[model samples]
Target: MLFQILLTLSIRFFLFDFVLFKSLRNHLKTKGYFFRKLLSCPFCQGFWSGLGVFLATHLIAYNLSFLLPMLSFGFVTAYLSMMTTAIFYPLIDKFEKNYSTL
Candidate 1:
């Protein structure tokens, strides 16, 4: 569980940070409504990434026979991840503001 959270968070931050760095960041975020909504929100990032990680792990490690239970647990995990991302988003913001080359 802990590992899942950390992995999700790390991947979230990487996408929310490094992947979007440089000119492509602003371009993609502004190009389409969908891209804007997806890229600009920490909650969205967290929820999708968190749920994806959970489901992927379940598929890889076990069978999908417990799909309903896994979905419920994954939803809870995603919620937790969403809150955690929101809480950490500002800290990352501060860091970027202080050090960003832009």
Candidate 2:
């Protein structure tokens, strides 16, 4: 379990950290108007939003697993990963809007 958790976190960090940073940097350069008006910092805001989405998805998966015996933890983890990626789209938009203004 520890190994799995570590592996999952490593993957998440590796995939997201640079992507998020770059995204913020790009948004700051290209879309300054939106971000400043929204009162959000792309790097900081994106990190927290991503973290929140990850945590919420995992919590939901874990809670549901209790009622669904056939749902393995691995399945939940995989689903969460996919879901996390999908959730990033809207966050990117928000980040762009928030950071561009600043």
Candidate 3:
């Protein structure tokens, strides 16, 4: 459970912070209404990425039981992890910057 949450959070951060965000904002900038809208906000992209990670982890772990309950739990876990990541993002960014400088 703990590993799943951490994995989901890490995947979400990588997707939103490194991959999807840059690709959407730069290469695909304003190319489409949907892409533009999605690129404009971190939370929106984060939520989807989080949800995807959670669902993927659950599926891989073979933890799926009740459809609705599992879906709900995954979503909740995703959101919480995403939010937790968001809260720590700035601190992590600063640490990375300081480390690179050193």
Candidate 4:
């Protein structure tokens, strides 16, 4: 049980902090809005984004797993990371703009 929880948390943390966030940073940099902002808070935004992605992916994965029992952890992790990043990109962009002015 503890292992499962830890694994879940680790996956969420890594995906959010590394994959999703790095992608956001790169995209923002490309857009010329690479300012550090306290708007909405990065950690807070990351936590909420991670939690939302975790829940949504779990539900989707559960349903899909029922149909195909070999979905694999890697696929789920990547999918969740991509989904969360896509969802939060716009919000982060807005925050980046806010941060630049300050």
Candidate 5:
């Protein structure tokens, strides 16, 4: 579970926050404004990315009990991962700024 949280944070910070926006900037300009806006925002991107990571973790850690209650556990795990990513974004931003100067 802890590994999943950390992996989600890394994906949110690197893939969604850095690579996607930078690499797709030109392409997004010619695309729908809403799609561009959604991808550019870290929080929005993080939510979806975290959910993705959660799904991957769920697949790896699958157990019969995890689906006993209609997949509620998976949903809750993903939501929590997303929220944690959002909450730590500011700190991650600061770290990036500092690291870039090193």
Candidate 6:
């Protein structure tokens, strides 16, 4: 469970906060105002990344172990990762602020 959360969190951070995707994000922004807005919001990023994580882990678990439950793990993980990512975003922001010149 913790691994899922952290993996989801890292996915969100990489997609939205990392500098590697700066060009992609800019292209997305140019595509539409909504795309730009979604890319800028951690909550939105978290939701999408969370869902992605859930689907990935779910598929693996479902195929590997025939004991997967009927729980809404996808949505549950989405919300959980969303909330956690939002909570941790400020710390990430602070790091960028402090070392943006480096």
Residue-pair clashes per candidate = 0, 14, 0, 0, 0, 0
Candidate-wise lDDT, in order? 0.72, 0.50, 0.62, 0.48, 0.61, 0.69
Model 5 clash pairs are none
User: In model 4, what lDDT does residue 86 have?
Assistant: 71
List runs of model 5 lying over 4 Å from the truth.
19-21, 60-102
Candidate 2: Cα lDDT at 19: 51
Predicted candidate 3 versus true structure: per-residue lDDT over 74-94, tens digit per residue? 676556755776788788788
TM-score of model number 1: 0.68
Q: Sort by TM-score, best first: what order?
A: 1, 6, 3, 5, 4, 2
Instruction: Provide TM-scores for the models.
Output: 0.68, 0.30, 0.56, 0.34, 0.51, 0.63
Tens digits of per-residue lDDT for model 4, 31-97: 5432333122344434444444445455455566443422333344445545555777788678767
lDDT of 5 by residue, 1-102 (tens): 667656766775676557335657657746998877665665556556656776666544557664553254345545664676667768868877788666
Residue 87, candidate 2: C-alpha displacement in angstroms: 2.8
Best-fitting candidate, scored by TM-score: 1
Clashes of 4: 0
Q: Which ten residues in a row have the lowest lDDT in candidate 6?
A: 64-73
Ranking by lDDT: 1, 6, 3, 5, 2, 4
lDDT for 97 in candidate 2 is 76
Superposed model 3: Cα runs more than 4 Å off: 19-25, 40-42, 58-65, 92-102
What are the runs in model 1 whose C-alpha is more than 4 Å off?
19-22, 60-65
lDDT tens per residue, model 2, 1-102: 545544564555454444556666556656677654322333333344444444545544556544353244445555555555566757867777788766
Q: How much does each candidate deviate from the true structure in C-alpha RMSD?
A: 3.4, 12.9, 4.6, 11.4, 5.0, 4.4
